[model samples]
Every structure is written in C-alpha cells, then in structure tokens.
Target: MKSLNDIKNIAIILTLAYAGITVTFLTYMATSVRTYNEIITYKEHEINLAFGYLFLIGMFTLVVLLLFLFYRAITISNRLLQQADRASGNYTIVESVELDKERRANEEKMREAKLLFDKEVESKLTAMLIFSPENLAEDTAFLEAIMLKMAKEFSAVQGLAYKYNKTNKAFELAATYAYFSENVKQSFTLDEGIPGQVAVKKESLKINNVPQGYLTVLSGLGKGTPSALYVIPIVVDSETVALLELAFFNNIDELLQQVVEQLEPKLGNIYAKFLK
Candidate 1:
C-alpha cells in the first residue's frame, strides 16, 4: 500500500534505472561480440568462462540499479513541478467593463472625470492624513473638496458621501458630486444610526432601504433614491478616527477593493513621518 507521493517517486526512479540499464547492456553486448570471437579463436578456456560469468552478474546488477534510479528521478521531478505551480497561483480580480463602450462613454467627459477623480483622491487622502492629528470635527471643508472633484468627473447627476464621527455624534459630509439640501450633512449620534454601529465596531455596514429602517434619518438625499450606501471606517493606529463613506455609486466598492490592496503598503510608508 504505497502512498500517492511514494508511488510517484518510485515511478521516476524506475524510469532512470531502465535508461541506465539499457545503455550498459547495449555497450556490453557490442564489446562481448568481439571478445567472443577472440575467446573461440585463442582457445582461452579459463578466461572465457570467467568473462561469461562476470557478464551475466553485471547484467543482473545493472537491471536492479537502473530500476531504482528511474523511480527516484521522476518522483522528485513531479514534486518540484507541483511546488512551482503553487507559488504562482495568486491572482487579482479585474473589472470587466467593455473597453470600447467605456472609452466611448464620453471621451471629454471621461477625461475630465478621471482628472477630477485623481485630484480628489489625492486631495482627500492628503487632507485626512494632515488634519487627522488636528482632530477633524466637521466635514464641511473636507467634503466640499471631494464633491468638487466628483462633479468634474460625472456631471450627469449628483453624488453624496459621508463619514461618521463617533465622538461628535454626527455623519459629516465627506464628499458629494451634486447639490443637496444643507440639512443632509447633519450628524447622527453613536446610538443614532448604523454608521455609529460601524464606527464603534470598526467594521463596515450597508443598508439598502434607509427609509424603512429605524436606525437614523437621511434628509435631503432626494427621497428614497440612494437605497444603497457603503460605510468604510478608516483606522489610524488601530483607533477609528473616521469613516470614509460613499453613497449612490454602484462601482465604488469594486474600485475601492482594488485601491485598498494597492494602498495598504503605501499607508505603511507614512510611518516615516512619525519616526523622525
């Protein structure tokens, strides 16, 4: 009852063994033919008999050695191949937006939107990193910067983004791409909404139908339109400083997923700021 791995090893050993045996046998056979003629012509009885016995024993030994070597060689080779395959198995998920369709989505609009989005992300991240130590109490300034960027990218409609401040007990306007009532920027207490729950637990939460839930009031979002909202809490030094919230965007999560993987190590480098 050999294990699978053991059997594989044995197979390779047998292959090498056979190869070696075949080569040795062929070489011996060719030399023996000429030697046989010499033996008969010279009448060297003792020498001929000794050579004959030695040839037979050598053939037997070669066969056994060749079988052993072949199995070992192949088994080792197979195991190495399996290990190599495992090392390269990791893969990253890619968005499947059609290149032609997205390209034609609005060349000028897309170009402007991309530029705006890049500036917005850079702006937001830099501001948060800078203002985090100062204790950002209001979302007024931060959200406005993000919203301006979003508007430049997608002008068709407006978008809204928020962040939860557990200490302040409110949902601050993190970013918006459209105009909305000023009341929409109101904050909710720690015990008030799902954002608070997420902030406290330091985890993300999503609710599809906000009006039906008793969690918190969402004012000025243009009725029950933004049914889906994503709540992502940003932690600095293991403490939830703020929640980087976004609303009314279907593809934001996918984009964030990709960015998070890329941004993870980068955030680590910012440690150099504190070291010096």
Candidate 2:
C-alpha cells in the first residue's frame, strides 16, 4: 500500500511537470509568433516558411506529449485497480481464517462445558441415590418410588418397572407412574417387544419418533402421545433382573442417558441385595 501511494505521488509530480512545460512552451511560442509576424511583414519569404515548419513541429511534439501523459494516467489507474483487488482478496482470506478459528474455539468450549455438566449431573444423582435410605423389602413400593423419582428428574411423562420372575422366565409389571390403561400388558418373555428386547440383551434402548398410539400421557386436562421411549435393563451377576421403561414428550438426549449409565452400579447393588 505504501508503495502504491509512492507511485501515485510520482505520477502527480510528472503530471505537474508536464503541465508546467506545456504552459511555458505555449507562452514562448505565442510570443515568438507575434514577434515573427511583425518581422515577417518586412523579412524574406524563406524565413516565414521556416518559421511555419517549426510551429508545425512544435504542435506535433505537444500532441505526442499529451498522448504519452494520457497513456501514463491509464496505466497508473489500472495498476491501482489491480492492487485494490489483491488487497481485497487478502482481507477476505484473513477474515475467513479468523472466523474459522473463532468457531473452533466456541465448539471446544461447548464440549468442555457439556462434559462438566454431565459430570455434575452424575455426581448429584449418585449423592441422591447413594446417601438416601429406603425400605427395600416392599418391592412394589420401592419400584414405584424409583419410577417417580426418575420421572421427576428426567421430566418423563410415564415410567414403568418390570421385575423378572426367575421361575416363569418372564418380565412382570411391577410398578407404574402417571400411566393409565384399561389393560396393560403384564408380562413379556425374552425378545418379545422393546422392553423384552432390552431385558434379553441386557442393554438400554432409546427410541425416537415413537409410533402413533404406542403410548400416551394422560393428565387431568387432556392426553398427548409421547414422542420417545427409553428402555433400560437392570442386570446383576450378568443376569437381567429387571427392566425400566420411560416415556417422554421429547427425545432423550445424551445427558439423560449418561445419568442412567452412572446410576447402573448403584442400581445393580440395590437389585442384588433387595430383589431375588
């Protein structure tokens, strides 16, 4: 940019010089023509002819100088335009790089914050379950309390717990929360349905975009269908002893899943000690 400015300054100086020289030449030629006219009125014809040739030559030189100045102006203008284009391109590239860096920084910060939040939630859940006391002998009541607590924490529309009966080799409905039905399926064998599948696999399952009429959330005001389903199997000694199912109006996110995973060990201990 500084160099471009220098070039502009030089161009200005040359233009001024050209203008001054043109004016001086024109002034001198005008005076000479006037003097020659007075002298030529009485001087030889040959002198008049020679003076005319000199005037034509001077006019030609002035025209050539004007064209050269015009061409120089055009050249300078083109160079300035090219320089501006290059500068603009460089600026865009720098701006893009800065924007990318800022975006990456923000993403990293979000990832860190998410990890911290997940740990905090896990810690809180651990404290609540680990430090509290309860009557584990009353299995039905215990299941109900667990469902209610989990529902409250996750904002679930409904929750259910199915205890595995070793003799029948089937999952029987143990407790329910915010669930209403004329007849609920009370039992499921291995690989029977979503709940049974989780129980058989001893793994959790999350379903999004729940099929219509799959499950409904009932309140005093009205009823609405749940949009998601989460089925988690409680395993002890490599045996799935029970299953917990939760329905939600929104999709289950990673935080909720993480909370459940964190609670697995404590839940396993509780199930191992309390339930058969």
All candidates: CA RMSD (Å) = 16.8, 10.7
lDDT of 1 by residue, 1-276 (tens): 267577567656655665565566566567665655666554655555555556566567566756765876798787777677557653223322454456677897889988887776665445434434322344444444434433343221344555545556566665655445565545555544666677677665654453443222234553434444555555455645454444543334433443443343343344323323
Those runs of model 2 whose alpha carbons end farther than 4 Å from true positions after fitting are 1-108, 127-132
- For candidate 2, lDDT tens digit of each residue in 1-276? 686577567667666665665566566556664555554564545555555556666567556766866887798897788678767864457766986899999999999998899787877586537423554666666667667777777788898889988899999999888889767789999999888778878888989999999998889999999999988788899889888898999998877787788777677778787754
Most accurate candidate by lDDT: 2
* Shift of residue 20 alpha carbon in model 1, Å: 74
**Candidate lDDT (C-alpha), each:** 0.51, 0.77
Cα TM-score per model: 0.33, 0.61
The superposed Cα distance between candidate 1 and the true structure at residue 202, in angstroms, equals: 1.8
